[model samples]
Every structure is written in structure tokens, then in C-alpha cells.
Target chain A: MKELSLNILDIAMNSVGAGAKNIAIALDEDDDSLRIVIEDDGCGMTKEQVEKLSDPFYTTRTTRKVGLGVPLFKLAAEQTGGSLDIRSVPVSESEKEHGTKVTAVFNKKHIDHTPLGDLVSTMVTLIQGNPDIDFLFLHTVNGKSVRLSTAEMRKELGDVPLSNGEVLNWIKEYLTEQYKEIERL
Target chain B: MKDKVALREEGSAATRIVVGMATCGIAAGARPVLNTFVEEVSKAGLLDKVMVTQTGCIGICQYEPVVEVYTPSGKVTYVKVTPEKAKRIVEEHIKGGKVITEYTIGNK
Candidate 1:
């Protein structure tokens, strides 16, 4: 992906494919590094599936093989002297604890670090397709942070789908405002 | 897919344009194509007739950024679409009621 946010969307889609009812994506950025964590209470992968995550990372994401979800994200991180990790617990191990968490740390100072692209669009696109689930997004830059939760929006909108044009506009505006405030601080 | 079926239960429009948005699709520039389709549909006042939506990989990673348009006749898949082509699709296919056969998957 050209931006780290696109990678986040790709991996989050994997969570949705796993039948996750709740998904959380967070970004923590400091002076030297940016950390992205996407955690989902989905049907986790088996140990065998989890073990496949360590395949060698590539330098170029686009020309790499198609249909792969992880190696590309791993490449985005590792190219910047960063790392990626995945922890999954299958339902057979413990039904209550079955989920997957992907943590990717990017060395922001590195020249190869990909920029964080339009996250509002990414979130809106995700919600537009899957309005039935809950998505929680939190981004922290320096000490300031912004948070958005579809669960709370659902509480307010009742039966309205997030894909509704007006609702999506509201979401974009809301996040834009929050981001502006965060950046101004 | 189950997702499209669920979406249809709400109120199926006369036409729908679905964009592929999996890892491969996004890396291949699907987002801009998707946004353009949505914008063009709304711009041409065809929002009531055309529904713009997205889906995960359709197992055609080689043709990343695939777009599927479902009209009353049937579904037509367009491969390797870009924002520019997406505009013409909205204008010719959706608005003009003429299928752009050159851009369809069958063209190749």
C-alpha cells in the first residue's frame, strides 16, 4: 500500500472476514516512531495459520505477489527499521479469548517510512461496507489524541446505516474537526 | 456474497456499482476509483438509481481494482479500473445507458 492507513484497512478487512463484531484500530505516533495496532475479537487463526505470518518481508509491496495481506504490511514496517507482530488465539484454545491482534511499529524518522494517508476516507469506506459492526479508531500524536466509535454513533442514530450519505458526511466532518484540534495543540 | 445480500435487504436500488477493496485492490489504486464512482453517481443525479459500494477481494488479484456493475440485465465486471475510466463508466454506462464494452472484463 502507498500509505500505512491503506494497510490498516486491508488488515481490518481480514478481521471483518473472520466474523468480528468489534474491531479497534489505533495509531500512536511520537517523534521517532509510529505504532499501529489493529485488534479484533474475531474468529482467531489456528496456530498453524498464525505461524505463517513470519514469511520474509519484501522491499517492494506492489510488485510483490497478490492476495497476500500480511507480508505487505510487514514490509511497510520493516523497510523503516520497524517490525510487525501478530498474536492470535483460536476458538479451540479458549472461546472467550479467541481474537487477533496485529502490531506494527514504523520508524517515522526513516526515509522509507510511508506516510499516513487519508484515514477518514479509510474509516468511512470500511463502515460504508460493513455498517452492522462496531469500529473504534484512536490516533495519538505526541500527547494529543482523537477517538471515534461506531458503537456510540449507533446509540445516537438508532437504525440509520453508517453508509448513508449524510451520516458519512457527518463522520468525516466530526473526525476532521477532531484532527484539526489535535493538530493545533 | 452475504454482505451484498444483507445490503439488498434494506432497499435494493435499480443499479449498483461494486468496487474491490482488498489488500491487492487498494494497493492497485482502488480507493480513487471507488470514490470517483460514488462522486460521479451523486453528481449526475443518479444516486437514486445507482448504488456505489465496495467489497473484499473477489479472488481476482491479478485484476486488482475490479469493478462490478449490476444493472437490470446482469452484472458486468470491469478490470484494472482507474478513476478516469470510472468517470466514463458513470457517464456512458450508468447515465447514457450504453455499456462500455471496451472496458468490460470480456474485452480482454
Candidate 2:
């Protein structure tokens, strides 16, 4: 993907497809590298699934489209002399806690490093489609941070859906303002 | 734009336009299609009547940037949708209630 945000969006969709009720996207950035950790409380994948994720062909051959998102992310990271790590626990009825966690570390100073695009739009699109799901986004640049949690919003909103045009607009503004605020830091 | 109170009372929008937003679709430019639908639908004052949303790819890699329109009757799947086509869809199929067969998946 041209933009890191697009890669994040694509990967997040996998979490959503996995029936995740709660998804957390965290970006920890500094002068050296940008680390993205996307954790999901979904019906996790098996060991085989996790192992096969890096191979582009294995994913595309399967019907579910595991190939496109992960491979692109791995390529993007590897191009910058960084790496992608994936850990998953297969869904087990006996175990209540099971999900997937993906981490991609990118060398910020590398010439091939893909820049983070409009992440605010990515967040809006995710919330706009899946209002029922809880999405928590946190970005920490140096020491300053910007965060949003739909779970917190639901407490204040009562019956108001996140998909509401008004609410989505507010989220867009909130994130955009936070991004601008981060730039001043 | 409807407030929280009015949006809750009326329930969700009656019609839905679902854009495929997976890697395949996004790579093929689904984002513009989605934004265009949302913009044109709102521009036509049809937000109350129609809602533009997104979903993961539905396994159609070749015919990506797919959009599906759902109404009272059924769904009409449009393939390889662009920003311009999204606007026409809102004006003709959505607001005008005339389906554009040429852009549909079955056009082949």
C-alpha cells in the first residue's frame, strides 16, 4: 500500500471479519522507528494460519483473502529494514480469551519508509461501518498522545449510534484536531 | 444534518450503499467511491433516505471497488465503481429510483 494508514485499514478489516468486538490500534513513534500494534479480541487464528501469513501466495490462494493485507504490510516494513510479527491463539470454547496481535516496526529514517497517511479517515471509516464494535485508537508521538475509545463514547451517548452522521462528523473533527495538536508539539 | 435525538427516533437510514473496503478494493480505489457516495447522497438531501457505508471485500478481486445497494426489494451489485459513477448512482438509481444495469456485476 502507498500509505501506512491504508495498510492499517486493511489489517483492521481482518480483525473485524474475525468477529472482533473490540479492536485496539496503537502507534508508538519516535525518531528511530514507528511501531504499530493492532490487537483484537476476536475468534483468533490457528498456528498454521499465523505461520502462513507472511507468504503472499498462500494468502491469495485461499478464499478468505489473507494474502493481500498482511503481505503488503510485511513488504512495507521489510523495505525499511524493519519487520512484522504476528501472534495468534486459535479459538477455543474452553478459553474465553483468544485473539490475534500484529506488530509492524518500521525504520522511520529509512529512505523507503512509507509515510502514515490520513489515519483519521481510516478511523472514521471503521467506526462508520461497524458502530456496534468498540474501536480504541491511540497514537503516541514522542511523549504526546491522542486517543479515542468508542466504548467511552457509548457511555456518554446512551442510545445514540456511532454511525449517526452527526457523531461521525464529531469523531472526524476530534481526530483531525488532535492530529493538528500533535503537529504543534 | 439530523441530531442525536432525531437519528435515534427514526432508526437507521432506510437504504444502504455498502462499499467494499478491503485491500483489493482499496487498492482499486474504493475510498474515492465511498467518499463520493457519502458526499453525493448527502448533497442530494438523501441522508435520511439513504446511508453510505463500507464493508470488507466480498471475494471479488477482479471486479474490485464493488458497491452494493440495498433497498426494500433487493440488492444490486455494481462492479468497478468510480467516484463519478457513485455520483450518478445517487442521482439516478438511488434518488431517481432507476437502476443502472450497465454498471452492475451482471453486465457481462
Candidate 3:
């Protein structure tokens, strides 16, 4: 993907496909690196699935012969002398607390690293596509942070759906303003 | 939440354009297709007149970069949409209010 945000969006879709009701995306940027952690309370993979996740040829999609999201992300991280980590515990009726976690660390000043694209749009798309899910996004750039929680938004919204255009506009403006603030700092 | 009520009061616009941007769509180049729609719609000053949003997984990955248009008339789905096609969609279907049948899902 040309943008890191695209990669995030792609990976996040996997969580949705796994039936995650709650997804958390955290981006932390320090002097040396930009780290992303995306965790989901979704049906997770087995040990074998987790092990083969990075292989381009391995995918659960029957329509296509290959899945490049993970492998491409792995390459993006590794090219910058960074790393990608994936952990999952398969879900079972007996155990409800099973899900998947993915973390990618990228060198801050790496020349090859793509800029994180419109993340607010990414978040909004996720919410709009899966309105019932709870999305919590935390972005900390040099310790200046902006946190957004849809669960809290829902509490405030009462019976109003998140799909409302007005609410979507507000969310966009709020995130854009926060992003500008971080850029200024 | 009150804001949502306010939006509902605003009611549905006469037309809405939805772009599929799921992983399948994006991998097939829906990002540019979406960007084109947003840009064209805004440039045409139809931001308030029309609603442009995104969706996930139309369940037809092979036919992606799919875009769907919803008007009072009905719904039309376009497949394998590129930026150029998106421009035409805004100009012909959206502006002219004529469904582009040749590019529609039913045609394929």
C-alpha cells in the first residue's frame, strides 16, 4: 500500500471479517520510531494460521489465491529496520476472551516509509461500515495525544445512530483539528 | 445524540453515492476511485446537494472498485470503477440525473 493508513485499513478489515465487535487502534510516535498497535476482540486464528499469516500465499479468502496485506505490511516495516508482530488465541464457546493483536514498528525517519494517510477517514470508514462496533483510536505524537471512543460517543448519542451525516461530519472535523494540533507540535 | 436528531430532521438528500472501499475494493484501486468522486462532487459544488460515503464488502470482490448510486428513482451499482469513470458518474448520472446503464452492474 502507498500509505500506512491503507495498510491499517486493510488489516482492520480482517478484524471485522473475524467478527470483532470492539477494535482498538493506537499510534505512538517518538523521536526514533512510529509504533502502531491494533487489537481486536474478534474470533481469532489457530496457531497454524498465526504462523502462516506473513506468507503472501496464505489466506483464508477462497475467492483469491493470495493475501498480501500482512506480507506487504511486514515488508514495509522490515525495510525500515522495524518489526511486525502478530499474536492470536483462537476463540471457543468455552473461552470468550480470545482475539488477535497486531503490532508494527517503523523507523521514524526511514526514507522508504509511506506517510500515514487520512487516518480519520480510515476510522470513519470503519465505523460507518460497521456501525455496531466500538472503535477506540488513540494517537500520540511526541506525547501529545488525541483519543476518540465511539462507545463514549454512543453513550452521548443515546438513540442516534453513528451513520448520521451530521455526526460523521463532526467526527471528521474533530479529528482533523486534532491532527492539525499534532502537526503544529 | 441531539445532533443525530438534527441530521434526521435534515432528511435524506435526493441522491447519495456510496463507494466500496473494503480491502478487496482498495486492493483493486477503489481509493483513487473514491478520491475522484469526493473531489468531483466537491468541485462541482454538490457537497450539500449530494451525500458521498464509503462502504465495506459488497460481496463481489471480482467486480470491485464498485460504486453504488441511490436516487429517488432507484439504485444503480457500477463495477470496475476508475477515476475517469467516477468523473463521468458525477457528470452524467449525478449531474445529468441519468443512470449510466452501460457501466452498471446489470449490464455486466
Candidate 4:
């Protein structure tokens, strides 16, 4: 909640919980606004469920009473003169593909907006935690862009585990370097 | 829970400390707990010796902010771990090579 990356991580966990094998997370930051869009090929919610998601008390989990991920994210975006949108198509729809998409837009210069935080760590953690899940991370800052995909990495890695400390360290460094390159562009 | 399996395979490190970072765990304030562990481990010059990482869910949300320490011998699960407790864990359990009984799951 403190950082945009943390909120992204939190929402991605929900995607994982929804049985998403492929999750695409995109962050677009420019002079005007910072927008994050997370789209997952997971078991999507029904219209009713999507409607109830804005409620702080609404949660599918049986463990605790409330689910704050959606509401908190919505609040964060709203505070920054932005908005949150969630779209989901049910798995039962034969004609339509089943998935969920969460988009949050925050004003770039908003005083209340939190920093991005350790985005490299967040991405590495997600990839390390769920190696089987394919994650595509695209970050575009002021029109300069960089993209990282686990599916591609997995093909290159072959037998080596993604969670391997060496590989994780490499990922962190790779992201940092890529961001620097993008920033320079 | 399933994520831990992938991490378990990366067994090259001498020690592995897993902090729960799932929604439940994070809501219970696991970020600070994780940050503390990473800071302490690095401060102690145990970067190569200890691998501090995170997992999604541990299945027990009630005992959130859960931390699991995997030594070469076995694994110890600690629940309700705070940043303060995380430092003590790094010092006593990780450095001293002794599990802090008071912080172990079900004990606290």
C-alpha cells in the first residue's frame, strides 16, 4: 500500500489465487499520469462479484473477514485524481475468453502518490514465488519502454530454476540496468 | 503455498528464510518483517550464507506474517513475526544457530 509496486504485488497475488497461468502487468508513467494495468488469464469474476469488489467487506477468502486489496487500490488511485477499473469475464462463457483486468491510473504529479518502491524486487519475488506462472512485465516511462517475460526466460534457462539466487540477482540487476537505459532514452 | 515448492528447489544457499507476502500476510504487516530480515541478514554479512526471500501464502492466514527458516538440517516456521522479532531472529536463530522457541508457530 505504501508503494505502487506493493499494491501491484498484492493484486498479482489475487491473480495467482484465481489460477492465472499467464499474467501481464504493464506500468505506463509519463508527465501526466502513472497508469498500471494488470491483466490475467485466470478464473474471472461474475458481474455480481465485480460489482461487489469495491466494497471493503467483500472477499472470496474464507480465512479473514475483509479483503482490502481492491478497495485500498481504488482509494489510492482516487486520492491521486485517478480511477480504478476492473473487468472480468466468467469462465463459463463459451464464446468469450475468461480473464480479469485491473487498471489503476494515478496523476503523475499528485502529492499523495506513493513512490514506485523496489519494483525489481517485486517482479523478482513474483517470478521466484511462482515459477510456473508466466509473468510479462512492461514498464514504459515517458514513452521509453522495457519488457521482461518469464516465458522467454524459462526457455533460455531450461533446467536452471528461476528462483535460483544467482538468477534472481541477475533479474534485479537486469531490471535496474534496463530502467537506466530507458531513462536515458 | 505452491510457490514455496519452487523456492525449495533453489537449495544452493546455506540458509533460506521465507517471509510470507501474500495479501493476508502483507495485510498483517509482513513487508516490514521482510525488510527487517533482509536488512539484518545483509548487515550481518550473511548475504551469501543466508537467502532471504518471500512466498505467497502459507495456508494459515491466522498466523500471518509467517516466516519459515530453512537450515541444512530442517525447517522452522515462525508466526506473527514483527520487524523487531525479525531482527532477533536474524541474531539468535540465524546467527546463533538456535531456533527461538518463543517465536515458533503455535507457541506465540
lDDT: which candidate is best?
A: 2
- Spell out the clash pairs found in candidate 1: none
What is the C-alpha lDDT profile of model 3 across A1-185, one tens digit per residue?
Answer: 77888888888877887889999999999888999999999888787777888888765555232267788888889989999999887786326888889999999698887788878877766775566889999999888998899999999888776765556667878999998888887
Model 2: CA > 4 A from native: A60-65, B1-3, B8-14, B72-75, B100-108
Model 2 C-alpha lDDT per residue in residues A14-91, reported as the tens digit of each score: 899888999999999999999999999888888878888887777554437576689899999999999999988868
DockQ of each: 0.33, 0.42, 0.29, 0.23
Clashing pairs in 2: none
TM-score of chain A of each: 0.92, 0.95, 0.93, 0.93
Candidate 2 docks at the CAPRI level of: acceptable
Lowest summed lDDT window (length 10), candidate 2 chain A: A59-68
DockQ of 4: 0.23
lDDT of 2 at A62: 44
User: Tens digits of per-residue lDDT for model 4 on B1-108?
Assistant: 223223334446789999988777876878768766766775686766788877767589899889999998899999999999999999999999989999998686
Instruction: Give the alpha carbon lDDT tens digit for every residue of B59-98 in model 3.
Output: 8989999999999888999999999999999999999998
lDDT at position A61, candidate 2: 40
* Chain A only, candidate 4, TM-score: 0.93
Clashes of each: 0, 0, 0, 0
How far off is residue A127 in model 1, in Å? 0.6
